[model samples]
Structures are given as structure tokens and as C-alpha cells.
Target chain A: MKQLVRVALLDSDSDVRFGRKMIISSNPKFEIVFESDGLSEDLVAVADGLIDVLVINQRLASGAGVSFYQSLRSLVGIKQATACVLTSAFDQPTLLLAALEEGVSQVVSLEQGPEALMNAIAAAKTGDQALSLGELYSLVLAETPSRELNQDLLRLVGDLPQKLESNLRRLQSVWKKGDAAELENFELKSLTGLVDKLPVKTASELVIRLQRSGLLDGE
Target chain B: MIRWIQRKNWIPEILLATFVFVVFGALDFATQGLLALLCSLVMSASLLFIRRFSFLTSALVLIFSTMQVSFSLLPVFALIGLLLVAFATGSFSQKPWREVNYVASVFGGLAFAADLAFNPTLDLAIFGGTIELTEAGRALTFVIFGLLAISMITLMWIFGQLLISRLLTVGSDIDRLAYEKQQLALSIQLAEQSKRFEIAGEINESVVQRISSVITNAEGGLYAAKASPEAAVRALEKTLSSAKYAHADLRRLFDMINLGEMVSSAPPSLEDLDSLTIAMRETGLDVSVSYFGARFALDQSAELAIYRIIFEALLNAKRHNPKGTKATIEISWLENGFQVLVKDNGVEVERKSALGANGMPLPYDVEDDIDSLLEKVTGPGITAMRERAESFGGSLEVQRAVGVGFTVSATFPVEAIRAAQDTSA
Candidate 1:
């Protein structure tokens, strides 16, 4: 018999906490040992030497998700715990970058459902990269291309213009409506991530052009 | 001590007169008999009251001179008495120079004629010994001596008049310079006061509004935390951000006040509109921004004015509007200028009085009209916005209708904006 993974959840939303609790309970391999609505002086007392995995809401009541994780990393007991960020639908890309820089092991979107959350948790426990395929692609797209492109590499990704046009139109509509809430659901990072998976040369050239034209960051 | 001397001007003149009187009395007592000595003492003593009773002293001196006409060298002493008469008359009278010259000529001529007629043969004194003069020669000598004495008196009178005129001119110039200095000081004071008022208006419009929004967001966060922890957390994040922004604004204002540089160093441009929209949205207001035409750079002051105008309009809309109200900002870059329009779907409310933060009555009157209501609610904010726009040769308009929402639009001329840009650059 394998030892059950001890997990701790910190979220300001009670519903999100309850949902995460139910999902972890369903899997016999994991057990929730501690939970909190926000980080406080008392949380330091409760979190001592108990949690194997720490799950936190990206938007905390007092500080940001990255900052909270940084604080937790300094604590003696939870320093070695696998850190994961539970994000909302409209989380900013800058915040995602911050979380990654803070050594967060996984980022699980609430809209991604319980299965994706479970997969991310399991992957985090096993010491493997827990980001989804699309998230990995976005990280790649966000990087600056180092070299120039050639025609032979471009040919590997067929019908590039059609896909680029489709994505551009979708982004334009979102910008025109000025509906920030709807923009969060559009998954712009995923579209760019798709482009980044093309042949290396083509992906590099395309990303450079998008960045130069200010289309990538939606300026 | 010098001021006292100036105030009692007659004291110095009296002391000088007494000194001259004593010297003349001793010379007369040694040279002449007791009668002449008595006449000299009487005339010299009268010099004490020369300044106080100048006319009486002149009369007494003339009487003493006439009584000593029989004396051999008494005519010379009589000439001294005639000079004293001129001095006393000139000092006592306003236009005494003409009278003094007439008196000196007549007295001098008569004294010389009396000396020639009464003692012409008696005088035998010369350079080393005695010399006798004929009657005709004595008469000619007396006439020449009288003419020379009159000329000397006239010259002295002319010099005294010049000294008085120069002193009067210097006094007038000092007065004019003092007046100019006072005027310059007053103008500088007024300019400083105006600058202080301008700074106050700027802080009231920008910093105060930001602080108020922070307070509102913090309260919202507190209430939301009780029901939905997630909502509370989001509200708290907003409150924190707003508070930081407000703090930065206050720091900037203080720096401007302390440094005497009222213009913003890093004023917000059109690129910053997105962040402002995001901030407003976080405060639970539905904010939308739209831009038309190609983007162009603007003068720092013009850009700051546009940003402030938009900020004030949005703040007013958010503060005065009902809950869930929607606001929109549209910016159009025209060929000759730029236009900004801010509109809100909120009902306009009537206000009973226009009062400032301290409950002091403001410049506007209370009314049910939208203009009065805006003036009452916004206080100095709207006035400051309008002033800023007009300062850059721009225009701002506020519109309100029965069913339509309140709207504010500002138009800025390209020429003025570019001119400001050139100056700053």
C-alpha cells in the first residue's frame, strides 16, 4: 500500500474549496489535511509539517498568488511542498509568468474541470511538468525567437495564412466588443500556443512578426 | 539727534547768529567809545531773536545804525547792519529776495552818502599812513562800494534758492521709488497666491477623487468578504491597487508643491487609457474605451489636461450614477485637433446646495438643473477641468437631457497642442 499524499488548500472562495475537497477525496491516493480562506498569522500554525502539496487560489484576499507562494517557500515546514496555483478564467498572462517564476509546480484553471485538476495534481506529486500541452505551447510562443527562418521549415506547416487569419479575426472581434470578461474566455494564449507548435523556423518567424506588429500582446 | 536738529531748524541758525553778534560787539567796543559800544551791544543782542522775530530785529538794527551815523567808521558798521536786515527779511518772508535786494540797495546807498557827507574829511587812514580825499572822490567811492555790496547779496540769495530746489527734487524721487517698490511687492504676493490656488484645485480634482474611490472600494471589499470570499478577495485587491495609485498621486502633488513645479513630470498619455479603463472596471463600473484615427503624440501639458478631463468625467459618472450604470469614453483624433467624449447611462439628480468639503458655500447656486447639480457635486473639480482645457486654447462642454445620460466632451486645437509640445521639448 502506497502512502496517501497529504494536500492543503487555500482559497478565499468556499465553493472552490469544497469542490477541490470533493475531487481530492474521490481519489483515495490523496487526502486534504489542512484548508484556509486566506493567509494569516494563524495559517503558519496550522500549516506546520502537515502538507505534502499546497494548492492556492491565484487571487488571495491579502496578497497575490505568486507572493503568497514566495512567503510559503520561506516557511520551514512547507518549503519542500509541491506548490500549485488555481486560476480563474480571466487570469492575466503577466500573473501566470509570475507564478512560473515563483517555482509554482502547476497551474490549474477552474474552468478546466475536475479531471484536469486531478491530472495536474498527480503530475505535480510525481515531479513531472504539470502544465497542459496548450500551456507549454504558450510559454514557447512567449519566448523571443533567436534565429531567422528558412522556406524549407515554413513548408512543414501547411495552410499557415488561413489559420493566422481565423485567429486574427477572432481577436479583433473580442477587442471591438471591449468585453473584458468575454476576452478571458477567448483563450488567446492557446491560439498563440498553437502557432508556436508549427515547424520551428515558421513558428519563430510568425511570432516575431506578431510581436513586431503589436498583435501578440493585443496593444 | 540729527532728526531733532532737522525738526527744530531755527536752533542752529540762532546759535550761528549769536556767535557773529559777540564777535562784532567786541570789535566795536575796542575801536569806538561807550556810545558806539552801547549801539553795537544793542544791535548784536537783537540778533538772538533774528529767526523768531526777523522783522523786529531788522527794524532795531536799522535804528541802531542810523543813530551812529556821526561816527567816522560807523558807516561800515551800518553796512553790516544793512546785511543783517537783508538776512532777517529773507528768512522771515516767502518772496523776500526782491524786498531784501531793494532794502540792501537803499540802505547801503544812504549809509555811504551819509558817511561821505558827515565824515568825508574826518577819515585819514590809508595803507600805511593817513591820506585825505576830496568830496567828489569820496562820493564816487561810496557809490561803487554800495553797488558791490548789493551784487554780493543778490548772489547769495540765488545760491540759497538753488539748494532748496535740489532738495525738493530729491525728496520727490525718493517718494516715487518707494511707491514703485511697494507696487512690485504687492504684485509678487498676488502671483504667489494665484499659484497656491491653482495647486489646491489640482489636488482637489485628482488626489481627493482617487482617495475617495479607494475608500469606496475598501468598504465594498469588507462587505463582499462576509458573503463570498472570492468576491471579497478581488475587491480587496482592487482596494489595495487603488490605495497605492492614490498614494502615488498625493506624492506627486506634494513634490509639485514643494519644488514649485506645478506641471506633471510624467503626465499620462493616450497609451495609459487602457490601464485607467481596467482600474475603473475593477471598481464595479462598466467602462468601455474606443479610439478613432491614427495615434499621434501631444504636448505634455495638453496630454495631462486631456487625461484629467477624462478622469474627472469618469469620476463624476461613477460617483453620481446609480449602481450598475455603464460609462463609455470615445477619443477621436481629428485633422486639426482632438476630441474626447465621455458619456454615462445614469440618471441625473437635483441638488439643493453647492457646498465644498468643509461645508462652505461654493460659487454656484442650488437648482434642479443638471448644470447646477454638476457644479454642486463636482465643486472645484469641474471648474479646474474647464480651466485646464481653456488654458491650452481648448473647449469643454457638458450636456444633460431628460432621458439621455450626462455627457462631457472636450476639444483641443492641434496648433496650441503643438506649440506646448515645442516649448516643453
Candidate 2:
């Protein structure tokens, strides 16, 4: 009989909270102690620091949940609890990075299914960031404004174009390796997440053509 | 690109200055000594930098004219350059020199009169012929020519002043037209962008969120299916319901685009607040709107959005409270941004609650405490209002206190509203 991870979840949407609770409660290794639709005095009133994991949606009622968490640090409890943020959108890297920098344990995207969130929570308790910090960095780099990205690259590495080419070549080689066990790799899954987001007409046309040619399928 | 800033293109003035020195200066050299030609050369050269250094040029014009008057060698080139300098001073000179230019030109005119009166050889051929005169005749000549010279100099300077202002007015009109064109373009762009943002927000908050919820419910069902098939079926049924909502919302967005329903008439804005208050008052909610800072026109979409947000708050106040509920809506356009604060004496919930925990029409036939009263007001309406505010990079905060009542505060930064629009207020 392994010890179950006690979880307290807070999300602004009641439906989302119900869904998340159902998912967490189904897992025998994780037990939901408390849940709320949003941050409130009721949180401290009910389940103060007694839970193993505290999962908060990044966007709370007032503002960023990270700020709320920062304020919560002063409540003279919760020294044993770990916080994991469920980000709705990964477009803003500054906020994501801020969450990571503010000692948030994990940044799980809503796009990933319940499995990823469960893994993030389980990993948080074990003191592991196996969710791939490299993937996070790559996403951050991909989303950074071009001007600032160039300046940052200049500070760290020398030539921007050369570095970009090298990175592409390296990624190509990595894809060519095609190791069977690497199917679960985070990098491959997160490949060109931004490219998927960008609404380029040419790409859409190619995708349509491929689907018509039976080389692709509609999602 | 204002003409005043590019005053360095003094080619025409320089050409005229050189022409004056070459032709009239030759006459001065031929008539008076080398010193007279040199004096004429110096005055003509002042035109080179008149547009650039107005004060210096005007000063030089006055000094040399006085010297020529004292020397009794009123050169031909000096008089020609004086007219140009007077015009330049009126147009280009700033502050004290602009004022000093009038006195300088007058003095130059007096100098000319004196030169014509005392030195008969330098009388301007344009005005009259040189006449042999006694001491009394010279006195009479000075007074007669004084008026003509004074009027001529003053008129030239005044004409310069008028010409510049006329050019400026034309320039300003052109600038205004260009600005209006840009504003129209920007308004269209922002309207389109705002539509896109709203769509994104809609998809993000509702569709994507619902799909994510469905995924969670389905995953939860898969895990729960191992033990209890009936409960798993119920959880999986929720997935279908959630997916249907996501699909419907997504279709609604696509229909908005496909049906060309994106373009519509301008919505009601801040200007319609009076009518809004009237409408509210008619509904038995006394809503008073007070503007704190100097008010200016906001973007059509932003204005509409803000008006909608404020209206929602007032509506909340009305819906929550009894008839004749007094609500004060304060609009402040501060240096930071636009802020809307609406405070109302909400429903007196010291008595029994209107609705139950599930918001059904069933409630305990008992008195409610302050905490339960506060909890009862947390409705989906406020959440929707918050979503609307957040769509525009704004925030809405609701404060509920026992005696203090309910306050809904929303803020929109100028950057978010204006998109770099300038404001005098």
C-alpha cells in the first residue's frame, strides 16, 4: 500500500474543477482533499498546508495565480506543500518563465491531457522536473520577440543565423535517429508548437493538399 | 519635415545676397571708397545666415546701417539687404529678437531718411530724384521721406509675418488631413484586431477550455471504468455534453466569419452614458455617472467595451438590490488610464437568503449571516463580466462588505484603449 498524494485543486471554472476532480479522484495513488472554483479566504479556512500538492490555474479571478501564491507564502503555513501551475496558453514565455522563476514546481499546458497534469503533480512530490526544462526553454525561445531574442542570443552565442542553422541541423539529426523508445520524448511532441499556432495560408494549403492526397488526415 | 526646421536651404537667399553684393556693391565701390564697398559686402553677407541665425543677422543689419548713416555712405546694397533681413526677422527670429526686429527696421528707416536728408548722393532712386536743398529744405525733406520710409519698412516686416503664418496654416491643415487619414486606417486595423482578440479569447475561454474539460472527463472515465462501469458511463456522458458545447461555440465563431456578420454599426459608447442612466433610472435603479478628469473621445470599440462593462456592473447592482436601489458609477480618466468604479447598496441580506446554495428557488426559511450573504452574490454574471474586462487587458474587482455594500472597480490602461492615441485631457 503506497502512500497517496493528497491534492487540493483551484480553478475559476466550476466545470473544469469538476472534471479535474474526477480525473484526480479516479487515480488510486492521488487523493483530492479539497477543491474550489477560485482563490478565496475559504482556501485557508478549509485546507491550509494539509495537502501534498496544490494545483492552481495560472489565471485566477484577481490576477496571475503566481502573485496570489507569492502573497500566500506569508500566511505562516504551507511549508510542506508544493505548487503546480496549469497554464491555459503557452504564448507568453515571460509569464511561464516567471512562474518557473518564482519557485513554481511545474508548468503543465492545458492542451496536454489529464495524464500530463497527473505526471506533473506526481513529479512535483518526488522533487523531479522530468517534464523537460529543455522543452520549456525551446518554447520560450520560439515565442520570444525577435529583437529581444536576437539580443539575448548575441549575449550568449555569437552568430544568430549560424546558430539557427546549427539548431535546425541538430534537430534534423535527432529526428533521423528515430529510436523506438524516444516516441515519448517531450521535444518531438512539442516540435513547432508555435508553427502549429501561426495561421499561415501556405501551410494551411499544404496541409489541405496532403489530406486530399491521403498523406494526412483531418483532426 | 516642417519648413522651419529645414531653414538650412538658404540657397535662394544666398544667391540674392551674392547678387546684391556683386551689382550694387560695385556701384558702392565705384562711388565711395574701399571702406564703403567692404561695409556693403558685410551687410550683404548677413543674408547668408539670416534663416539660420536670425538674431545675429538682424543685429548686423541694424549695426551696419547705423554705421553707414554716421559715415554718410549709404550704399545701394545696404538698402536692398535691409528689406530681406526685415522679412527674415519677422519669419525666422524668435523671442526678443522678433520684437527687436521692429525697432531695428525702424531705426534703419530713420537712418535712411537721415542719409537722404544729409547726404543727397544716397537718396533712393525708387522714391524721388536728388534735389539741391538749403538747411531748412533738408529738414522738410527728412520729415516727408521719414513717413514713407517708416511705412515701407513696417509694411515689409508685417507682410513677412503674415506670409509665414499663412504658410503655417496651410501646413497645419495638410498635417491635420494626413492625421485623420492615419486615424481612420488605425481605427479599421484596431477594429479588425479587436475582433480577432475577442475570437481568440472566446475560443480560449470557452471552446478550448471545454475541450480540455472533456478530455479530462473522458480520461477520468477511462480510469474509473475499471471498477464501476455505471459511474464511468456517467463521466463519459459529460464528455459528450462538453464536446457539444465546444463544437457549438466553435461553429458560432465560424458562422460569425462566414456570414460576414463581423461588420456592424458602431455600438453604444461613453457618449451614450446619459441615455443609459436614464434607462436604468426608469427601471428603478438610480444610476449616477460622474466623470472626474477631462473627458476625451475613446476608440469606438474600446468605448463600447468600457460602456458594456460599466453597464454590466450597474445591471448587477440593479439585479442584486431592491427597487430604487441607488448606485453611483464613477469614471476617472487619470494619467495612468481610464477607471470605472460602481458602488451600490446591494440587496439587504440580513434577512433570509433569496436563493439556495445551488442558486435554485429553494432556500432555508431562516435568517442569513453576513458571510452567507457575501457568498450568495458570487454569480456567473460577475465571472462573465470579468472575462469581458480581461479580453481588453483590463481588470474587474468586486468588493462586498457588510456595511460598505458592493463595489465593482474596473480599470483599462491608456495603452490598451488608445493604441498610442494622443490625448490633450
TM-score of each: 0.26, 0.38
Candidate 2 residues lying further than 4 Å off, grouped into runs, are A45-47, A77-80, A83-95, A130-219, B1-203, B255-425
Model 2 reproduces a share of the real contacts of 0.43
- lDDT for each candidate structure: 0.59, 0.64
TM-score of chain B of each: 0.36, 0.42
Q: Give the alpha carbon lDDT tens digit for every residue of A63-134 in model 2.
A: 567765655654533243345544453335556555654446666776667788888888767655433523
- Tens digit of lDDT per residue, candidate 2, span B93-123? 6767776766777777777777878785554
> Chain A alone, TM-score for each of the models?
0.57, 0.57
Model 1, B245-301: lDDT tens digits are 778877877765664323322445667778677666656567899999765678755
Best by lDDT: 2
